[model samples]
Target: MIASFPYLIVGLLFLFGLYAVVFERNLIKIAIGISVIEAATNMFLIVLGYRTGGRIPVFTLAGESKVLVLPTPQALTLTAIVIGMATTALMLSLIMVLYRHYGTLDVREIRRLRG
Candidate 1:
């Protein structure tokens, strides 16, 4: 039970983000929710790669440790962070454009104004 605490946190974080995305009416809030989901994913990747008494996977910098944590998840998490930043930026930009066009941040209002 204690060993699985991190996984439990990840599940909770994902659920919170999903709730915000589904129930929030404000564009900014929805964008923030998406970011939270991305964060949860990044954290999950890191947690998945963590090992007790394991050293970093850098051969040149690592000491004499037989057990090394996998580096692939870390690399993938870094890539996801970069991509998530770009995606969030794009989402915010679009939200700004919508606000300028509709004069409101509410998703329902924007939809109504579209027609």
Candidate 2:
């Protein structure tokens, strides 16, 4: 049970983020939800590449052989984190612009203004 704790937390984080995205009416809340989802995904990727007693992928002595955790997932997670940060910043900027025009951060008000 303890071994699966990380997976469980990740699942909950994803679900909470999805819930916020679907139910929250505030633009900032939606942006936060997106960030949460991205974080959960990154965590899942890192966990997938984790191994007990694993070593970094590097050339060692001729007589040394050890389990090496895959580095691809870590690389992918780093890229995803950078992209997510950019996306969150873009979303917040758009939200600010919308608030300036609509005078509120409520999604319903913005949608009504669109029509």
Per-residue accuracy of model 1 over 1-115 as CA lDDT, tens digit each: 9999999999999999999999999999999999999999999999999999888887666666567898999999999999999999999999999999999999999888887
After aligning candidate 1 to the native by TM-score, how far in Å is the CA of 49 from where it should be? Answer: 0.7
- Candidate 2 has what TM-score? 0.92
* CA deviation > 4 Å runs, candidate 2: 59-64
The clash count for each model shown is 0, 0
lDDT tens readout by residue for model 2, 1-111: 988999999999999999999999999999999999999999999999998888877646423567788899999999999999999999999999998888999989888
Error of 2 at 78 (Å): 0.6
Tell me how far the alpha carbon of residue 105 in candidate 2 is from the true structure, in angstroms, after superposition: 0.5
Total clashes in model 1, counting residue pairs 3 or more apart in sequence or in different chains: 0
Q: Each candidate's TM vs. the true structure?
A: 0.94, 0.92
